[model samples]
Target: MNYQWYPGHMTKARRMMQENIKLIDLIIEVVDARIPLSSRNPDIDELGKNKARMILLNKSDLADERENEKWQEYFTQKGFHVVKMNAKSGAGVKNVLPVIMEACKEKIERDKQRGIKNRPIRAMVVGIPNVGKSTFINAFAGKACAKTGNKPGVTKGKQWIRINKNVELLDTPGILWPKFEDQSVGAKLAMIGSMNDQILNLEELSLELLGYLHKCYEGILAQRYELEESEDRLAMLSAVAKNRNCLKKGNELDYAKASNILLEEFRNGKIGRITLEQA
Candidate 1:
């Protein structure tokens, strides 16, 4: 399915990022571990040029462990300091600060040489919507310094949070590109709850997800739904609906309900530690 979502606030958010990017010494980019490349907004490379960069693979607990390692290596090869983390439970969060210092060692030494002592390293957290920027900030800061929400666009403005004497964080709203030129990227974002569900066709999306799972993660559906996988994706969804007892008053299968259940389970990691994209 083809997809595109660009809200008005995102335009403003982009402008805000451009205005505020120059104030920070580092850019902390968070990407969903399941779909790291798809979740990344390439504009950040241009927006954050010449700044220290760190890639936090958030929600790593839900992604395939092997894929996480590959993604870490992929980004490291491109010179980004990478950390795999689950911001919700604060797992792997402790490594972030030290990695940030290491990534910006040159800048820190320059400050010392110029005698600019005690300047806190300024970093701005940025990512596409629902990739867990606010959660990361709260976890990293050891407090709820920013508002956290499961829905996209929870962070509407900019707020600087001081994590410690030596580091400060500027939290910005998640910004998606104005257009998704590749439809696969949009689909992956939608699967990860980065897009508004009201505007999507859940049943069709579920079918797409089922097809992907059947191909890449073969026994997931069989294990989760207790039904044999089928070549026809719709047939597999029907089996899931029957197994889950999603039915209407007339005893017709409620495909929509079944679809929602499947999507939610996958997003919550009930299906397993599955990664949608590979390095």
Candidate 2:
């Protein structure tokens, strides 16, 4: 699918991030563990060029365990301090504090050298829409400091959350890049609910998701829907509709209803701990 979603607020958020990046010592970038590379905004590297970087693989509870390990290694090799976490449940959230200090060790040491002591480390949480940035902030801060939502564009402005005496967090609104040149990246993001659902064709999106799952994770559909898989994704979807009783007024299969069920179950990990992309 040809996918492009750049709302006006996201443009304003990007500009705000560019302006605020200079004030923070570290960039705590949150990415979906299921599609780490696709969920990242490429412009962040340019905007946060000189700052210390930390990659949080948020919502890791829904991703493949082995893939999470691989992604952690991948980012760590690229000079980023990585942490895999489920922000909603606060799993692995404790590890983030020490990792933040470690990531900004140089800056901390510089402050000590310049006789600027007892200053908290400044950090900013950033990510693409629906990547769990707000949830991570609330979990890491051990309070409901930032607003949390499942949909994209919940955070409209920036808020500085002081976590403790030693740390402070700047929470910014989720931002998407101006455009997606790679269709695969856009598809992956859409599959993971990073895009606005109102603008998408759910049936088409579910079909694409089924195609990927059938290829990479065999037997998942059969196990979940209790139907024999087929080479044709639409046929499999039809079977899913029949088994799930997704019928219309005339007792005909409701493909759209079935599609919504499939996408919702997959997103909530009821289908399985599946990862759409690999490191």
Candidate 3:
């Protein structure tokens, strides 16, 4: 299992991010809670040097609660303000305001020291696409919020959504690329449906998923699909196909159809609330 990310796209995004980063006080980064490390692009640390950072573990409702706690502790230990949230449902959204204030306390105090009053903490929401950035922005900004248009000497056509008196969020989110150096990381990203499916072998990918579930979460197969769990990965997949009646024109069992069904079920949480990785 090998993977390659678009360096050209990343380079362009980095340049744009560098240009936009100077105008902001904090970087609110979002990552999928199921594959926290894999979904993150490490270049953000260098790009956002000396800036206050907050990590929102998005889509936490589908992940293991215990692992989510461990991940929060891990990020906090490294000096990042971490929040577990389900951006789609707006769960845990209320907690972000105080954490934002906490993350940018120094900047807020600096404004007061300089006789600057009522200055909102400017922030940019950043993340890899499909990690719930748009959904979060909608939830965070809500219906009644106003967009502060471009000001004199500011970047042309820049707009900010005033999210209350204490904070104003950038209308656009900074896009980051996924890490594809490690094969395992790539596999994990694929399993979570973050990567493009066109480049993947669905049957092979399904087997890899089965392997992980068999190890991390035993008996999930027997319970969900009514298939016998076996040490042989292909045999388990065949059983799944047989149980689901995934067949082709000649009445032959179609592993590809079964693979698609399995992956889709897992991705949409039809199988269950399962997390692919652990602490």
lDDT winner among the candidates?
Answer: 1
Give the higher-lDDT candidate: 1 or 3. Answer: 1
Model 2 superposed RMSD (Cα)? 0.8
Candidate 1 local distance difference test against the native? 0.94
TM-scores, each model vs. reference: 0.99, 0.98, 0.89
The per-prediction tally of clashing pairs is: 0, 0, 0
Per-model lDDT: 0.94, 0.92, 0.78
lDDT of 1 by residue, 15-54 (tens): 9999998899999999999999999998999999999999
TM-score of 3: 0.89
lDDT per residue, candidate 2, 36-139, as tens digits?
89998999999988889999999899999999999999999999999999999999999999999999889999999999999999998999999999998888
Candidate 2, overall lDDT?
Answer: 0.92
Q: In model 2, how many backbone clashes occur?
A: 0
Ranking by lDDT: 1, 2, 3
After superposing candidate 2 on the true structure, give the runs of residues whose Cα lies further than 4 Å from its correct spot: none
